[model samples]
Target: MALPLVLFDVNGTLSDMGRMTQHVEEIGAPPQLAGLWFATVLRDGFALTAAGENPAFRAVAEGALRVVLAGQVLNRDVDDAVAHILTAMQQLPVHPDVADGIRGLTAAGFELAALTNGAATTASGLLERAGVRDAFAAVLSVEDGPGWKPAAGAYTHALAALGRGADDVVLVAAHPWDIDGASRAGLRTAWLNRDASPYPSAMVPPDHEVAQLGDLLSALRT
Candidate 1:
């Protein structure tokens, strides 16, 4: 059998978005709101997807940040705060385990690609900075897809772009929604449960679960 292509979700899956909290503090907003702001961005983005609208990631992120920063006392204006946070996202470093994990998967002869809701350039820059950009066959963005993920069209777009069948791909992500969406789209899924949080009851269970990205090698071998 041919090895299944590994489709990685780039944000929280490969990159360490938690560092945004530090940027939030540096910009004079409550650090904790960084998480809330990101969550709100996803919430609204998903809502837009469900409504048949596709908003750019940066647009949604900046709008959500403004809402989150409203009424908060910041050293800079709200626009500056939003710009600082978005800039921080663009410069995010990949998680420590990601490079080795990606390298291992590539060494094992499985094709790899990055499927992100954000700009493809962001994903490319992140992997390049981590020294693993060459491992990916492609860096994809929802901007080029039919819609953001969890929408069937997005997964279909990726499979078509890769010239592979859904059954020949595995979607790896840290988010339950991403896993659930891929499962529903007829692809295998591996959930990177770095936080050990319980899976959402409403989502489909992942085929594999690991606390770290490197653990996926062992998980897939079995």
Candidate 2:
């Protein structure tokens, strides 16, 4: 049998997004406030896309950061702070389990790839730094498609790139929305439930769930 293709989400699935909030806190900003800024970035990114605008993910993220920092009425200038934050983001560290889990999956004969809403540069840089870029057969971004995901086409394009259909692929992600979107596109779903959070009731149940990526490969043993 051809091993099931493994498609991963880049951000929360592979990397630790909470670190960005903690990074801002290290600079004397409140962690919750930093989270708010990060949330705004996601909101704006989707809005721009739905509006038929093609703002780069980095630019949308920076704009959201500007608005977030300015909202507090602090003396700090938003533009400079945004620049610092962007650079800091590029340097954000990955979770310790990421590299090993990826290696395990590869060793298990899974054809690996990534499908991310993030810019290709940002996603590749993170994986390269984590020393697992070589494990993936492909790394794709939504920029080449109509928009970022929650749109079925994002997952559709990703599966197409792998030259596989829904039955041959499994979409793994930490986000419920991403899982829902992938499922809607007819791919088997795996929820990397790192947070132990409950799944959303409105969505279809995933084919698999695991608290850690290390457990994921083991669970998928054929």
Candidate 3:
């Protein structure tokens, strides 16, 4: 069989969002708000996509931050707090397994690409900082598509960019919704269960599941 192009989901799958907890605390909000704030962004983005609107990730994230920060004690004003978080989002580092995993895949003759609901620049920046930007064949965003991912159009856009069909790609994501959507869209799916969380019974299950990114090549080989 021909090698499948590995499509990666950016946000939590590639970037280490947990690092943002300190940034949130720096703004005088409770550290737990970091997770809640990101959940809000994904919730709003998914809601907007379901409503047939293509929302910008950063815009939705900023709005979600405002909502999350409202009525909270802050070291900075709301606007500044929002700005701080947004900047931190762009500067998020990649998971420890990313660089080695990506290099392993590349060395094994697999094509790789990034598909993000966020900006291409942000994804590109993350990969670049990890010293693996050139390892990707493409870095795409749902902004170029009809809507955010979990919506079929988003995956379609990525497949089209790679000039490949659904079966020729594998979507790897930490989010179950993303894995389910990609599976439904006819692409192979891999769920990166970084924290060892149980897969939700409600979603379409991934074709492969691994505890870390570095395990993916081995999983696929098996």
Candidate 4:
């Protein structure tokens, strides 16, 4: 059989979100609040998509951060902190396990690609900075399909770019919603359960579950 293509989610699945949190803390804002605000950006972005609107993820992140900052007393250089966060998103540090596992998977001959909620250029840049850009046959974004994730079309866009059928692709993500969305779009899914939660009753269980990308090699090999 032809090896199945493996697609990965970029943001939380591969990048360490600590950069955003640390940047805000240095600017005298609560670290957790910064993380919460960053998360709210994604929530609101997805909500807009669900409501038939499409907004840039960067815009949403900045808008949400500003709202959270409006209620707080910030004394340090706030704009610089926000800039750092945005740049961090563009040059995300890979999760410690990502680089090795991706290299291993590539060496094993599986075609690889990245599917992200960020813009196309942003995804390409981040993957380059993380030193794994060469492993991906393609880097895709929800922007390519004119909508955000869980929309079916987003995964469709990615699979189309890779010249692969949905069933021959395995979408890997840390978020349950991402996995569910990819599955709904007809791709096989592997849940990278960094947090190890049980699946909800209605959400389909992933084809395979692994705590880290390193574990994925053996699972996929089978």
- True-structure RMSD for candidate 1: 0.8
- Clashing residue pairs in candidate 4 (N, C-alpha, C atoms within 3 angstroms): none
TM agreement with the true structure for every prediction:
0.98, 0.92, 0.99, 0.93
Indicate the residue-level lDDT of 76 in model 1.
88
User: Looking at model 4, how many pairs of residues clash?
Assistant: 0
lDDT of 1: 0.92
Kindly give the stretch of ten consecutive residues in candidate 4 with the minimal lDDT sum. Answer: 73-82
| Candidate 2, position 64, lDDT | 80
- Candidate 3 lDDT at 54 equals 98
Ranked candidates (lDDT, high to low): 3, 1, 4, 2
Query: Would you list the C-alpha lDDT of every candidate in the order shown?
Result: 0.92, 0.82, 0.94, 0.84
In angstroms, the error of model 1 at 105 is: 1.0
TM-score of 1: 0.98
lDDT of candidate 4? 0.84
Q: Per-residue CA lDDT of candidate 1, range 1-222, in tens? A: 789999999999999988988999998888899899889999999999999988899999888888888899999877777778888899999988888888888888989999999999988999999999999999999998878999999999999999999999999999999999999999999999999999999999999999998899889889
Model 2: per-residue lDDT, tens digit, 14-67?
Answer: 878888886676455667877787678778877776777656778888778777
Backbone clash total for model 3 is 0
Error of 4 at 119 (Å): 1.8
